[model samples]
Target: MEVIQVKNLSKNYGALQAVDRVSFAVPEGSVFGMLGPNGAGKTTTIECIIGLQKRSGGEVTVLGLDPAISRKELYGSIGVQLQETVYQDKAKVFELCQLFSSMYPDPLDYKLLLERFGLEAKTRTYLRNLSGGERQKVAIVLALIANPRLVVLDELTTGLDPQSRREMWAYIKELQAEGRTIFMTTHYMEEAAHLCDQVCIIDEGRIVALDTVDGVIENAGMDTMISFETQDEIGMVLEKLPGVNRVEQEHEQVRLYSQKEDVLTDLILLLREHAVEYRKINISRPGLEDAFLQLTGKEWKEKVS
Candidate 1:
């Protein structure tokens, strides 16, 4: 079953169209990801789906009901963690958790959530006193407090440290194991590649590609990259080899891109034929980031750290 369906969705701000006829579906019990560069309408599209922003045109349904009309009911079944969250500075951690729990008919154990997020000791601490990472974890705990069947996370690990980021990833996997649907927007391509079952790449308010991680990479026509440091100036010679698409040489370093699986063997034979000595050789396959760059012609600016 599809937990979320969006068809020809569009959102405009005066003369500018932020989301242009975007269509996609999030399957139940699967992790769906929306990816794009900054200001490419990722956030706008998400806001429209969750009823936080009104769309200019198109249809949106969340868990079988129209989000714009059934927002109150939808909120009970869906938990959302937006990219940015603000709270009363004077409020304590436990106080905010209790407040959010009151709004749901069946809330999870907030204390257990705090402990899992490593914030149990900070329950009595004021929100203003917590670190940025701690505050972000609090937002996540509140989003899950409703025991929602569908969870929407925008930039889930933006403010987290490396360890906390891994922990959150594990928790997301746990959610999926329990048969929950997850829809998320993220600038981290590796995160999408690792966690998402399906990904939609949007550029200039339009979807450029939508597929599984490997499918996107394959469809982008991206090839395996082989690079090495070679003292021999064998320029343009590797390009003549079968399966080699492109060859680049820079000072004593060479990079080759190939589409065929036998390219490595052919490359070795060619190198031996020319007696070209190479070192520090490395081979890497195209990933989500490579596909995004190929389709959008733009760099992913967000650093995972």
Candidate 2:
């Protein structure tokens, strides 16, 4: 089932077009990743879908309800955790959890949430005393506490430590197992690559690419990097090989880069035909970041920085 649907969605800030004619759908019980670089209209699109801001134009239906007209009903089914969340500096973790839980009907157990988040010890800690990662954990706990059918998480693991991030990913997978739909936004391509069933890449207020992680990666036309060590100087022979774009040789090693689908097979055959003995051969496929860069025409690091 399509839990979320958007068509011709547009949002504008005066003369500035924040989001332009964006469209996509999120299936039920799936992690839908909405990815874009800074100021790429991702945040604006999110706000519109969640009914936090009025959209300039479009059609949006989440869980069979229009967010504008059925906001109260929508809120009951969706749990939202914004990119930046703050609480009373003096508020205890338990207190904040208790407060949000009270707002929902038949909320999840706060004690279980604390245990699941490895935050039992910090239950008494004040919001001001918690580390950035700890504060993120608290926000996650509150968002999921309602046990809502749909969870919208922005920058879900932004400030988490390595271990904590992994833990949170595992928990999200568990939620998916329980048939909860997740709509998440993040700059972390690796996280989105691993967890998202469908990835939507937006840039400059438009939908640039939307597909499965593998599909997007393939659509980006990024090359696979193949590198190996060889004592022989066969650069001249390899250079003429099909699908070989560029080859760099450093001492006894040669790094080959190609975008051909059958580059690996061709490379191995060429090496055997030339009687080349290679060691430490490795092939690196294009990752989600590369795909994002290709779609947005922006360097991931530059966009984030």
Candidate 3:
């Protein structure tokens, strides 16, 4: 079942086109990721879906209801976490949850949510007293309080540290296991690669590539980077080797990057012909990061730390 459908979605601001004819469908009970760079119009596309921004052209439907006409009805079925959140400084954590829960017809257990997020200790704590990660956790709990069928999360792990981010990822998996659909946008490539069932890469307000994470990687038409240490001078035949894209040498180690998966076989043979040997070979597979660069023609390195 398709829970969300967007067709020929276009948004513009004066002479600048923010989003242009973007189209994609999110399946029910699946994690769909919208991946792109800072100015790629990702936020505009999401805002169009949630009815936060009106599009210049195109159509959007959430749960078979038009977002523009059925804005109130749609809110009950979908939860949202924006890129930034601000809480009332004087409000307690538990108090905010209660306030949000009352707005929905059927909300989840606030105490249970607090316990699940390890926020039980902070229930009575003032909103201003919580850390960044804790504040984000509270935002998530509020979004899920209505037990929405579809959740829209933007920059899901923005301010989190490595350990806390991973923990949140695991929690998202739990939501999927319970058959909840997730639609999200993020600058983090690894997060999209790790959690997305289907990915749509956008650039300059247009859709560039849409496929599964592995499919997107394969579509990049780029090869893996293979490196190893060798006492012998492998630079002698590096350019002459078949399936080699480029060659980089750093002292005793030579790194060969290629598009063909079997490039290593040919490389090993070439080494033997030259009577050169290497040790501790390492191959780095092409991932979402490479796909983003290929699709958008942008320079980006994953900031995992």
By lDDT, the candidates rank as 1, 3, 2
**Looking at candidate 3, what is the lDDT of residue 102?**
96
Q: Candidate 3 — worst ten consecutive residues by lDDT sum?
A: 296-305
Write the number of the candidate with greater TM-score, choosing between 2 and 3.
2
lDDT of 1 at 3: 96
On a 0 to 1 TM-score scale, where does candidate 3 land against the true structure? 0.90
Pairs clashing in candidate 1? Answer: none
Per-residue lDDT over 1-305 for candidate 3, one digit per residue giving the tens place of the 0 to 100 score: 99999999999999999999999999999999998877789888888998888889999999999887888899987898987766897999999999989989999999999999999999999999988788888988999998999999988787688888888899889889999999998778888888999999998998899999999989888778999989877675887777787998889889888888788889888888888878989999988887788777887754322
Model 2, span 88-206: residue lDDT tens: 98999999999998998888999998888789999999999998778887887888888888999888777666677777789889889989999998878888888999999888898
Model 1 poorest 10 in a row by lDDT: 296-305
- On lDDT, who's better, 1 or 3? 1
**How far is 284's C-alpha from truth in model 2 (Å)?**
1.5
Over 4 Å off, model 1: 231-237, 249-251, 270-276, 303-305
TM-score of every candidate: 0.91, 0.92, 0.90
- Candidate 1, number of clashes: 0
Question: What's the residue-level lDDT of 77 in candidate 1?
Answer: 87
TM-score-better candidate, 1 vs 3: 1
lDDT of 1 by residue, 132-182 (tens): 778878888999899998999998887577777777788889889989999
Model 3 C-alpha lDDT versus the unseen true structure:
0.88
Model 1, residue 202: distance off in Å is 1.6
